[model samples]
Each structure stands twice: as C-alpha cells, then as structure tokens.
Target: MIYRREIDGLRAAAVMPVILFHAGFSFFSGGFIGVDVFFVISGFLITSIILEEMRDGTFSLAAFYERRARRLLPALFLVVLCCLPFAWLWVMPEEFRAFSDSLIATSLSGANFLFWFKSGYFAPEAGEVPLLHIWSLAVEEQYYMFFPLLVMVMWKRKPSWMVAVLVAIACASLVYSEWASRVFPSANFYFLPSRAWEFLAGSICSLVQSKGQKRGSDPLSLLGFGMIAFSVFYFDETSPIPSTLAVVPVIGAMLVLLYARQGTWVSALLSTRVFTMIGQISYSAYLWHQPLFAFARIRSIDPPPLIVMGALACLSLMLAYLSWRFVEQPFRRGERRLLPSTRSLVASVSLVLAAFITFGIYGHDTRGIPWRLPAPIKEFMADNDWSKTCLLEGSSGWDAMPIENCIFNGSHAQTYAILGDSLASSLTPALTKRLDGMNIGLQQITHSFCAPVADVSMVPHQARDCGAFNAAAIEYLVKSKVKTVFLAASWKIFFEQSRYIFNGEEVATSDVGQRLRDAFDKTVGALTSAGIRVIIVYPHPRGDTEIAAKVAKLMHKGTPAPTITIAQDEFLQQSSPSYAYLDDPKDRHVLRVDPAKIFCGREAGRCDLARDGKTFISDKVHFTSAGAEAVADEILVALRQDDIMDGNGVAALSSD
Candidate 1:
C-alpha cells in the first residue's frame, strides 16, 4: 500500500535483461527470469493493497478494476495501435493473421493461451512476433482476475485462513510446475496453472509483512540479491522454468521484499533516482521493445548488426519514457486525467476495446489485407507449392510419407530414399517430380528437426530424441534394401544453434564437434555397410533475416524487387562443420550435394535469395518449390556423373 522506490529500482533490474535477452544477447540467456521477478512484485503489491482495503472495509471490485484499467490498458492499446501501419507494410498474410490472432487475444487478456497453442515447431522466430511480450501481461491480468476473488472469499470466512489458503495453493502449483516443466514444457512456460506458484510466493511475502517485521537485516537482503544474480548468470534456456531451479529467484525476490528496508545497501542501491525512473517506465519499456525488435528484423534486408540492435534497444527506452508520460500518466495520475470518473473510464475503455477487437477481426478476416501489396510479391509467397507437400512438420517421427508416386524405379533390385529433417522433406516434392520423368521413384521419410544423424540428440529443444528418429529411418531403409539414401537437414542450425547430447550426458561444448564427427561416421557407416550409397544434402545457403518477409516489406515501401544476398564465404564459414565432415567423408562413396554452390555461385562471392527472377529460399534455410526443383536438377546431375544412376534414364517399375 506504500510506495517503495526500491521496488521500482527492482523493476529496473527485471526489465533491462528481458529487453537485452530478446535482442539476442547471449549473456542474458536467463533474462526471461525477469518476467518471474515481475510476477512476484505484482503479487506482493496487489495482495498487500487488497488485504489493506479489506481491513479498512473500503474494498470495491469496481474501483480495483478501474485502477487496473487505468494502469495497464491505455499504454497497451497505444502500442498495439502504433503496430498496425507497420504490420500492414511489413508482415506477410499468414504471419499477419497470426499477428491479428495475438492482437485479438491480447485485447481479450488471452494472449498467453493463444501463444501456447500457436508455439509449435513452426512458430515464427521471437524477433518476428511483434506482440509476443504481451503474453506476460496477459498472464498477470489472468492471475489478478482469479487471485483477488480467492483472497476475498478466504478473508470473509476467517482472516487467518487466507495465508494458509495461499500457501496450500502455492505448494500444489509448485508441484504441478515441476511435473509439467518436464512433460509439457511449452505449456508449462506459457500457461497460468504452472506459473501460479511464482505469484503465490509474493502473496505469502505480503502476509509475512502484514504480521510484523521481526528481523530485517542487510545480510538477508544481500543473500537475496546474491540469489537473483546467481540465477541470472548461472541458468540458461536449458533450465526447466519455475521448477525447483526457479524457486531460487522467487525466494530471492521474497527475501529482497522482506528485508531490503531503509538504510540497507541493497535498498539504497535499488532506491537510486535513475533506478526508480527506469522502474517507473519499465512497463512501457517492456511493451515497446518487442515490436521495435520484431519490426526491425522484419524490415531489414540483412540481420541488423548488434550496434544497430543496441541503438534500437535505447530507442525503446526513450519511447517508453514518452509513453509513460503521455499515454500512461494522464489516465492514472489525475492532474490532467482524461477519464476522471469510473463511468467515463468504463465507457472509454469499452469503446477502445470494441474498436481494437473490430480491427483484429477485420485484419484477420481480410488475411492481413493482401491487396495492400503488388500482386507479384503476393503471388511469390503464395506460389510455395512444396510447403504443402510431404512437410516434415506434417509427419510423425519415422512414419513413411505416402509418396509411393515418388519412389525410384530403376534397373536394379534396390531402390532409393530421402532422409533428414524438414529441409529434406522440402526437397522431396521437387526431387520426386524431377525423377518422375526419369522413372526413379524416391521414398520420402523425414521428421521436424530430426537431423539425419545417429546416436546424438539436441536435448533442450527435442521432445523426442532425433537419434531415435534417425535410427528408425536407417532400420526401415536397410530393411527395404534401399540402394542409395540422400541425407539432408539444416546442418548449420544443428552445428550452431542446438545443444547436443551423447549417451544421455550432455556433450561438453568443447566436445560437440568431436561428438558430431563420431555420429556422422556411425550414420554413414551403418548405411554403407548395408551396401547403400549415400549423398549428403548439405545445408542450403542461409540468409540472416527471414527473406520472404523482408522482400515483401521492401516492396510494400516501393523498393523495387529487393533481394537478400549473403556472401558465399560467410555461408561456408557458418556451415564449415557440415561441409568439412560430409564433403570428405571417410567412405569415398559417401557422396554430397551442395546447395551453397547452386544458390551462391552466380553473384561471384554472394548468394541471392532468388535466381533468374525466381524466389527460392523461403525463410532462412528452407526452400521454395522452385528452389527445391533446381536443387533436384543438381541431384540428378550428381547421380549421372557418379554413374550411380545410368545416363540412359528409362527403367521399368517394380512392386517388389
């Protein structure tokens, strides 16, 4: 119920790391914990206010809601409103619909659930999702919607039972968080059921303060600061959220609240003028940063440099200060308050809600307003035929895609198959059609993110082991007596973006290179031992930004047919591991296909997103149907030159 400059300073602590983390700073990989910190702060402040109001017999749900509305809604609505023109100019149709979905959900206080449902393997990258951060506000709003009611009910029945009720619910939520963190990690991360414990931790902290401060000391505050700092520096994305691992930060926040009193160094540090200012603007800072980052990525032709990203991060803070003053202050502070009464606030808020909801419905139903772009740019994205065919995301692991039409019909008893992750499946449709003329039926087998390797897994991201997926593919191929297998994946991603494991223990970061060497050797060995020929479909040329969206954004702004170009040397550097290992396999017959050569060779040192006015690379590494078809032509060339498939390409089909 009392203002604490230290708490505001604590807000400064929570918001900066989140902005930096979302800006792709690896040092702040655990920066997402800032949201949990915010949860604790919110629970404590809101609960303290409610309990105090109840004690004075002056609590009104209508008044409480009006305060929440004034505090949160106006600034949020302004941010969303500003994003509209940018979304119009930049975001592609399907992506725009998703943005619209978030818009509607955010307006309805359901963004967390929408995001959880939408966060599949194919979800857009965090930088491309403009309203992604709104999910946190949605979570907090949902918490308040229920938490106050529970507290009120408990207070009416018996004042002492409120603390007990909070404790019991918190314990149950903690247990659920631990169990769900392992089993339903995405759901656990986004939804309220698994996150209630973090809020309840703050609720209990409020109750303790109410009873009276017995032993507030600097040591406890220092320990709390130490715990918060430890979690921030020591934990990473691999850490299960809000599990026992998260209790450190939650309890740390509680300790800080309980003991960071006047005269304590921690309190003094948190109560600084700069920290309170940053804290005062923190909510607006959080709202503004995601859109700035997302739009910057969407609009840039190349990956925006770290310096540029840093500048944008600063710009967000500047914008936050303005938003806090102009949009947030007027609604809450009352000197020049636009809505001075609850009636006026309700009417104004309802109208804004209806207008935004209508905008969301209109934008979504119009499919992100396709008519806003030239037909050529619109057609270019719409013509993604391979995107609809034999996609890795469409398959359950190791299941044979019913592509009997694509099977290789050859002179020999053995047949052919394609294997890898989604990248492999992207090639299947184009490879299938290319070989159809040659009567070579190619069997299609792939899975999402399932690197076509053996005996290793990307432990943090993989729900099922990639090793198992590859194992099943190898077994099926061997049993089917396939003659040659073409292995493909986003090799650059596996080598760089993922964390690896061998034999159930994490492969040391230093040892990942050697572990991958061993895995590739085993994979090639198993197939080669079966008398099956192998062709490595090396990773395609990668663009720094999502290419299609970037091009569309440029075109909408009257830039003529812009393209994303990456240097060949840079591609090789990014993908050196895949190139070196797969290109010069120990087995001489372990052949390879290079997408970099096909995509990058034309521009001397640089690779273009399209060739001959045909767009190919879809996002970063995946291919368009036209691009896949071009790559298929190269595969055919390799087969003929290597004398694996005869130059005279006609053969009869065999059901055997």
Candidate 2:
C-alpha cells in the first residue's frame, strides 16, 4: 500500500482544530469533530492494510498485534513517562490518584471504560488527568483487536454478506447510542459499543474499493466536503455529539476519503505537505496537547490568555516532533527485528503486567501507603468519620431519605430541614462531624444539582423534568415547617449559562443564580417570618483547581500541621470574578462566609496550603473532602455556636 500524502493532509486538518479548541479558542467550537475525522481516517488506513494482508494469505493475528504494538506503544509509553513528574508536581492528591487510575486504565487498553465511568473528555474535571486522551486510543485499539478477526472469519465464507452484517451492527449501535445519550449518557458517550459504528463505516468504505463502487458524480464529493467544512465552522458544543447528528461528519469524511482521489479540488487541498505533516504526527500531537493546555490553565490560576495558549501550541508541536522521531519512527519501521511470535509474547505479557501494577497503585488512597498528618493539625483534621454522614454523589441510600426527616439533628433534634444544592451536600462531611459531636441526629434532604431558588426564571431548557424538579424542590422547601434551615449552593453556576446538548438538540441557558435569587429572598424572608431560624452560609472562595490537589500537597510535604493557609484576597482576585454574577446587593438575608482565609491564607494572597503551587478546586467549583474540611473548620464554628445571630455580625436573632 502506497503512503497517501493526502491522508496526512487530512490528518493535519483533523488535529489542528482539536488542539485549537482545547486551547480555549472559541472560534473552533466544532473542532471536537476532529476526533470523528481521525476515526474515519483510521478506519480507512487500518482496514486497507488488513485487507491487503488478507488477500495475500499473510494476515497472521500474531503479526497483526506485533505491528500494532510496535506502531503504537513506544510513543505512548514515552508520553506516559514524561507526564509522571508533571503529575506529581502539579496534580493534587485526588487528581494524582485519578491520574494513577487513568494510567492503569490506559496501560491495559481499558481507558474507554475508565473514561466512561469518569465522564466525557470535555468535562472540566477530566482536563486534570493527563491520560484522558488514551480513551480514543482504547477505542481504536478495541476496534483493531476484533475487527480484523471478524473480517477474516467472514471474508471467504460470505464476502458480500459481511458488509450487511457490519452495517446492521453499526445501525444498531447508532440507535443504542442515541437512546443511551438520554438515559445513561456517561456510559453511552465513553464506551466502544456506542462509538464502534464510526469505525465500521470507514471499514465499509475500505471494503468497497474506489474502483468498484459508484463514484457518484464530482458534485457529490463537493457537497460532502462543503458539509464537513460547514460542520467544523458552525456546530458548537450544544450540538448533540456523536449521536445521529454525528452522521454529518462521518458521511462527509467518507465522501472526502472516497472522492478525494478522483480529481476533486477539496481532495487536492487536503493532500498538501503542510496538511500531511500535521497528519503524520497527529497521534502524538493529540496525546501531548491536552496535558499542556490543562497544565497551563492550572498554573496560570486563570484561563490561559491567547498569547500563552499560542506558546502551548508551539510547545505541543515540538513535543510531537520529538515523540515521532524517537519513539514512533524507531519501533514501527520493520528492520532486522525480532520475530513476530517473540514480539507478540513480550508485548502481551508486558501489557498485562502494566495493568496489574497500575490497578495495584490506584486501588487505595495513596496506594494504601500510610503517612502522618502533622501533629497539632492532625488532631484538628482527625476524629471526623468521612462517610458516616456525608453522602457520596452516587452512593447508595443517599436520595432515599423521607422528606419529613430532612432536618439537621445536632440540637433539640426532632424537627427537620434541608439546605443548598450539590455544594451544600459536599458540606455533609463537615456538618456530620459537628452534628455528631453535639449528639444530634439530622436528616439531610437534598437534590444533586438543583438549588432551592424562590422564583421560576429559568434559562430555558428542553428538560422540562429538571426545570419542574427545581420548581417542586422550591415549593417543598417553602412549605416545610422545619424549625431551622441551612442554605448553600455553587452560586457561581446559577448565573452562568452553559452551552450543552439535550437528547440530540442544541440548548443553552443561563446559570441558575438570577432565576433563583428571588426565591432565595422569599424563602429566607418566609422562614424568618415563621420564627424558624434560617441560615445562609455564604459560598466559600472559588479556586481554579481541585480541592483534593491542595490537600494532597499538604499531605505529601510531610507537614500535617494546619499552620499554613491560602490568602482569601488572592483567590478572590483570581477566581471570584468568574463567580461574581451571583453577588447581588438586593439579597440581604444571605450570610457571608469566607473560608478562603481559614484554609489558604497564612501569607498575604499566597496560599502555601498545598505542598505544590497547584490550585485546589477540582474542575472549577467543587471541593474535595480536604478542601471542604478546611472551609468547614472556619465556618463550622460560626454555624455550631450560633455566632452569626442574624444575617450579619450584628445581634439580630437573640438566643432567647
């Protein structure tokens, strides 16, 4: 098989935009489609080789796997090796653990499963793990593992019938993906079964050689190319991804791959040297780009400016070149090399060992390694059972609590109350700690993402059920006769609108803050009027990184002492603006709490809180257990003692 420069150009076309999109350039919103583009190209290339081998009666499974290992593993292993220090130095404990888990997953070609359980590649938390890109490799590798054997089995038996079988499978997977996108979105999005059709489509293209099939007129290719280009430019994240809508890019890629050779200008353009170079190292480039962008974003403690992002692009290209030269080129080129059988045995055993080692490392926190939490600080942070009261997001029995029992129980504890949204629930560890100390039994009634805002101004969503649930929660909160109430939420998320898809449709809506403010005011007013003590725990300072990372830093330094703290002002200066939309002057009943000073503020604006300089907020807003405790230690005093007698420091509510 001849090397197609045009294919390389196609590779360049596919990778550049994905790099740009990840770098925060909003212009290439649809640049994510680059993965789909790569998928199509891979199917064509790999299938072409397999078919060639099949025709010559030389397609041995052993040789096929050896070729795959030699072509893929070296560069990948190098990338993983390079990331170790960066991960240790920059990633917090929780993130480090996640990275370790992903490392194990990637080594074993089970990254697709890991990522499916973890969430989408675009999820904010996902950017922290360096091994995230391996999911794609896993998908492709899974395809290679079985696709060739399936083709081999069918090739002689029913050459024509195989296409129908594959097409049927692809169609079925598409239908399953579309449904799963609604029901089990994470599973559907990350798993190979849902994504297999894209590769299979390309396989179909390879099976039907260009000379044998209908070229369909020159106009068809033009239309296909135009559709693909249009998709790259016009589609945004809100577009239902890789569902039925994915057909546009897949079909367009198929068209371009099919017709590009037949003198079409689009094909000629894609065949250029510049494009070919981009394609040549597309794999390494893809692998390196995400970690670079993610690290830069973490270090800046802010989103990367355009200039910094540009520098990252240059850095990525250099890394890609280095990887391609040293790692990729050497092993892939068949030289005076080991026999295929020998290579296969070595590769298989090594992969299996890598999997076992990785799993062992990630199976426990700190890989089950024990270390001390600093003396005085250890006492402060100790004595809290993390799981007894605080509920894990997907933990069993969390949401099953009866509505009547939704009150905090540490005091004269028969009455019930619930407060806040997801952020509030995170505080359960801290809340449970204090409540347990007081010997009070409290029932926590909570919703995962919905906050109990007082009004009905929504950002307009297609999920009427979610919007209705928000409404129902508010009504329930307002009507419930609990003696005391607590309020919390990621106030930042409420005001900001995220552009995402819902069941194959594009939908964008404002954050929940504005829509929720009125209800907040009314709820507080009503609770206070009813003579029920109501408390609004003002949000803690937002950080740019995961909370676990910060705690991990402290843990790793061999200093378990709580002497060091991050500055409230510095964190606010850097991250509060992103969340400032929730700060409305009209809402006076809301109490304010700034735990940023408690956990991160020993120095002026410089938090030596973490062993490293990495920020500690996971993704953008949620806190890990360590982060939540740091804040809880500061605010819990005020909460438990009733020091905040009223909305402010002034004595508005009497102990009488």
Candidate 3:
C-alpha cells in the first residue's frame, strides 16, 4: 500500500549475510538465518498489499501473478542463462548431471523437492551445484502462489474468524515443524508445510497492523533488530531450522516489521541510502552469489582464499545492480512491450521453460554431455572401480553380502574377510587380486558409511543397521571359522558431523569419539578372543577438494595432467585416532597395515596424490583402481612381515 524504505533496508540485511555465508566466511556462521528474515518480511509485505487491493475491490489473481512473474523470472532466467556456459565448460560429468537436474527442477518450481531427495550426509558433490540456492526461492514462490488465494477466499468471512483460521494454521505448522526438525531435518528445511509458519508470522503482522495495531516504540524495535543480529552471529549450520529456535528471528522480524514505522529509530536507521540501495537490488544480489562462489570452488584446486571469495561476493553485487538495472527493469517495469501483453508474457515464460527443460533432459540423458569433454578426459572419468556389484552398501549389510562368492577360493583352506565402509570397498580390487591364488580365500564384507566399530552410531539414522550388521559379521566370522580379518575405513569421517547418539541419549561427537575408540577396541577384543587374526588398515590420506574433478578440470584446461598432493603431517594430525591404535607398541597382538607408507611419501612430508601424469583418487576421499593397488601393496607388505604368512610366501593363519 505504501513504500517503506526501511523494508528495503531489511531486504539488504537479509541478502548480505546469505551472500557472505555462502562465500564461506567464518564470521557469518549464523548467516543462513537471513533466509528466515526474508520469509517473514515477504509474508508481511505481500499480505499487506493483497489486503489493501482486496479492500479496494481491485485485486485480480491474474494481475497479482503477472506482477510476481515480472518481479522474479527475468533476473532469475538471466542468472541461470549466464551460468550455462561456465557449467558446460567447468562442471565434471557427474556434477553437471546434478546441475541439469536442478535447472529442470527450478524451471518447474520444484528444486526444493529435487534438492531434498539428493541430500545426504556424504553428498560432497552438492557444493558443485550452482542452482542449489534456488530451493529457497521455490519455497517462497510456492507460498506466493498459495497464500493470496487463501486470503481471498477467507476474506468474505467475519474478521475474527479469518484471523482465527490463520492462527490455527500457523500453530499447526509451527508444531509440526518443531517435531519434524528432529526426525526429518532435511525435509523440514526444504518442505513448504514446515516453513509456512514463518510466512504466517508475517501474515499475522500485516493483519494486526492494518487493523490499527499500535506502532512499535524505539526500545521494542531496537530489541527486534538486536535479536535478528544475535541469530545472524550466534546460530550456525548445525542449528535446527524451522524449529522453536527459529522463533527468535521470526519474532525479531515480526517486531521490526510491525513496530519500525516511518519515524521509529529502527526504521530511520534502515532507511539509510546504503541499505535501501542494496535492498532495492536484493533479489538479483541473492540470485548471483551462489553460482559465482560455486564455480570458483569448482575451478580452484584448493578452497579459494577468502579474499578471492570476498571479491566474488562484491562482484555478485555489481552484477546484481547491472542486471537489476538493464534486464530486470525492462522485462518487469517498462512499456510492457518486452512481452506486450499477459498472453505474450505467458507464452515467453512457457517457451523459455521448455528450452531449459529440453537442455536439462539432454544433459541428464546424455550423462552430462560426455561429448563436451575431450576424449582423453572422458577416459579419465571412466568407470575405474574394479567391480561395484560385490560392495554391500546402503541396506545390503551383513545379511546381503555374498561372503562365499566374492572369495578368491572358498573351497581352499582358510577364508579371510575384509570389512569396513566404502573406503574398504575401494581397496578390494587390489586386495582381492593379491589374495586370488594365495591358497587361502579372501571374502568381502564391507558396507559404505557403516562404521566398522561396534555399539555406537548416529542412532535412529536412516542408514543401514550398522551396529547389527557389524555384530552379525563378528558372529558370522566365528561361526564360519574365518581366522583372519582385515579392518579398514575412513575412520575420521563419522566424527566430522556435529551431533551423535549413544546409549539412548543425544550426545556431541566428543562423547561419540570416545565411544568410537572403545567400540573399535571392543571389536578387536571380540575378534582376537575368537582366535581370529586381525589386520587394521590405517586410513589413507584424503584430498581437501574433489581431487578427481580438480584433476580433470586442470587437465581439461591443459595443466599437463600434473601431480596432486596434500600435506602428510596435516592428514596424520587429523587421523590421530587411527594412528594411536596403530602406533601403540604396547598392543602388538592385533596386527596393523599402514596405507600411509604408500600414500604419504616422505618427499617434502606431503602425501603424493598421483603416481604419474594421472591422479589416482577417484573423488575427494575414495581411491581409484591405481590408488587401491598402492594401498593393497602396503597390505601385502604387512602380510609378508606378519607371522600369518607361511614360509612358501602364501598368507595363512600361523596356527593352521
């Protein structure tokens, strides 16, 4: 109904943190709360306008939707269109496939659902997605599409009943969100029902304000602003979004919107030129930052230094201003000649959507357009994992593993087993190859992300029954007369998360860490007591970025297929848990295999990631066939040094 420079200033407030947060600036840890702030502001502002229009009998759903399409689509399509060339040139095949999926989903206003499904604890490839940020916009757009019709239908009711309905819906959604935040955190984050309460908070604000609710005083508005600032600084990625914790920022925004009227101190401050200007271009600013940062990350071998990211953040704003000036304005505000009429605008939108959908289908169907890469790069990206079929990952744990089949020779004397997560699976080809004709058999019992340790996990998690599976393996090994077992995994990967569950209580990883160590010790004790020889393969060095993609990008850009490496000392420092067990001279009964002897070369104290022109790491942490062979050689050397080896050079139980 009326322009509020303060509202524009608040938009500036919301957008800046989101930009900085995505840029990986540490100080902006709670910066993700900015989206919550925007949700509240949008609900308030949009509801306020709809109510004003309906009161004047001038609200047309078509006009309302046209304005929304005008306000949003031009800048959005422009951003996605600009990202296409870079995505074609830079994104690796797998990541490009995901990018195409997001492009299609965004065009359909369903990116949130697509992203929700793709999310997982181990989804490292997600960072490469430039369209990842569009999930929020989808949530917002869904609200815009639904809420106006809701208000229009309900407007004919008595005032009190209308307010009551809004209140009931908000309460139900808020209650549901709180519960879902614990059980379905990812879905809660992306789903509309869980996030609807935030919009309702603002909707209630508009209703009360239009009914002559008193303007907020200086103290109240200032407190509102302070709460917003607190969430921005104090919250973090671990914070449960849309839960009761979100009430802090939601109420903060509600207060600022309701109380910070024209002359109020908070309003005066927000009305400043700098904030208003950024706020004016905030939509475009929000759209531009993610692609810039993601592409920069995709290109760099290392995490881009903050200064470079900082420069890119600033560049996003400059581009935002330019597009806001030239592209967004002409399509949204000018003589209407760009589309000329609503029919033409709808046609143009549908055609553009079809084009993106076709492109996405092509990219996805063609496996991220393999033709885009040079033939040699395609060779580098080829399926290098020796055999994926035998890996007992996902729900296929102890029961699903075909123990007797994967073995080199089950009919031979003793059958040994290798057990752990995907890291262990990655090492299997070489290990199985080495053990093929060793007179004894080698079996695979590995499952991806299933911790090798016993008695602990992120409980109630949607993963395979790791504790049950591991316990079964122990029982199976004893029952099957398996005398030797190889234990390996990316040990530190589990503790990288924020929260864990142990002993029926919610606990921090600090508690989980101790339980992990104890669990491993308990597992070893169980095995050794059964007269089974155990070889614990220490974790290999992990690259900081997606090593395979980084290598491919470099080679694709003519970097000569160079050697890639990471600091050995740094890797060991992070891997102290595995080292502590392996390094202990006091415990010599349980044998150990150190992969670092092969992966972490002594040259300059850095772990060499490549043996020749080709990098061996398949991704950030998993090994390619060559890398697996290197680690397997270390395991072979350890076998040679162990008493398990017979004098004839075949590995066996010394007792046998």
State which candidate has the highest TM-score: 3
Ranking of models by TM-score? 3, 1, 2
Model 1 scores a C-alpha lDDT of 0.80
TM-score for each model: 0.76, 0.69, 0.86
Instruction: Kindly list the per-residue Cα lDDT of model 2 for residues 1-656, writing each as its tens digit.
Output: 76656678778878888888877788888888888888888888888888888788888887788778777777777777777667656554445567777777787789989887766767766655667778889988998888888888888799768779989988998898888776566677677788888888888888786337635446767776776777788888777667888889889888877777736677677777677777888888998988887766554444669888988987998899888977787666668443335656476649755764564375345732222333432332232112223322222333333444344553554443545566777666566565566564455655555454543322333222333344454455556655556666666555444532222343455443343454455656666666555555555566444444344444445544323344666656654643453344233343345554454545555654443422234434555466666665655555545643545532222111
Q: What local lDDT score does residue 525 receive in model 2, on the 0 to 100 scale?
A: 67
Clashing pairs in 1: 406-442, 407-441, 407-442, 408-440, 408-441, 408-442, 409-441
Off by over 4 Å in 2: 182-184, 214-218, 338-356, 359-364, 367-544, 547-656
**Residue lDDT tens for model 3, 274-377:** 99999999999999999998899898766789999999999999999999998888887656547869999999999999999999999999878877888888
Compared with the true structure, model 3 gives a TM-score of: 0.86
Ten-residue stretch with the least lDDT total in model 2: 379-388
Best by lDDT: 3
lDDT tens per residue, model 1, 572-642: 78888767666545664566677666777676888877654466777677788878988888888777767
lDDT on C-alpha atoms for all candidate structures: 0.80, 0.63, 0.80
